[model samples]
Target: FINFPVFFSGVSMLIVVGVALDTSAQIESHLIERRYEGFLASGRLKGRYVR
Candidate 1:
């Protein structure tokens, strides 16, 4: 039923979000190496999952 579509959409969203977050973290680290500010003023971007 509608539940299947809802579950699929939710999983898709999580995947997209995970990729975006990982990409941003890489970008932030690169920028920091060049003495540039990242997404946060503090320059600390956490991953999607807490370590």
Candidate 2:
């Protein structure tokens, strides 16, 4: 029974990571379709702080 918790935690971590990756990919695809930079764009670093 001691190993059960560890196993469950590992499974949950994997699920969370998978969901995050999938969500990011979807968002990136949408952005690209709209001809916009992605969340991880490596362009001029334009943002709220960039003047």
Candidate 3:
């Protein structure tokens, strides 16, 4: 028999990860479009770096 609670937990985690990826991508695009140095400043982290 299938464990519905466990399946739902796994799916929720995936959803969270997907949302995080999308949000980070949007942030990265905004930063790039601003004509900056891709977050190379002190204590500043880029999308790739955060990943």
Candidate 4:
């Protein structure tokens, strides 16, 4: 059986990662829409419907 604290910790990490990803994507999209570079310096981030 898993320890209670360990299980909750894992779940908390997952939530944190999910929120971070979502927020970054939103920011990236906004930047791209305004004809600015993305968070990465290499190139623009590709979206599902846009380049």
lDDT of 4 at 49: 58
- The Cα local distance difference test for each model comes to 0.74, 0.74, 0.75, 0.75
Cα RMSD of all models vs. native, in order, equals: 12.6, 8.3, 11.0, 9.7
Evaluated at residue 30, the lDDT of candidate 3 is 89
Q: Could you tell me every candidate's TM-score relative to the true structure?
A: 0.50, 0.53, 0.53, 0.52
> Residue by residue across 1-51, what tens digits does model 2's lDDT show?
455555569778889899999999999988787665444465554564664
Kindly list the per-residue Cα lDDT of model 4 for residues 1-51, writing each as its tens digit: 765765578779899899999999999988786665434554755563553
In terms of TM-score, which candidate is strongest? 2
The candidate with the higher TM-score, 1 or 3, is: 3
The true-versus-predicted C-alpha distance at residue 16 of model 1, in Å, is 0.1
Candidate 3 per-residue C-alpha lDDT over 1-51 given as tens digits, one digit per residue, 9 for 90 to 100:
665765578779889899999999999998786656544454475454663
Error of 4 at 35 (Å): 0.8
Total colliding residue pairs, candidate 2: 0
Candidates sorted by TM-score, descending order? 2, 3, 4, 1
Hey, what RMSD does candidate 3 come out at? 11.0
**Residue 10 miss distance in model 4 (angstroms):** 0.4
Q: What number of clashing residue pairs does each candidate have, in the order they appear?
A: 0, 0, 0, 0
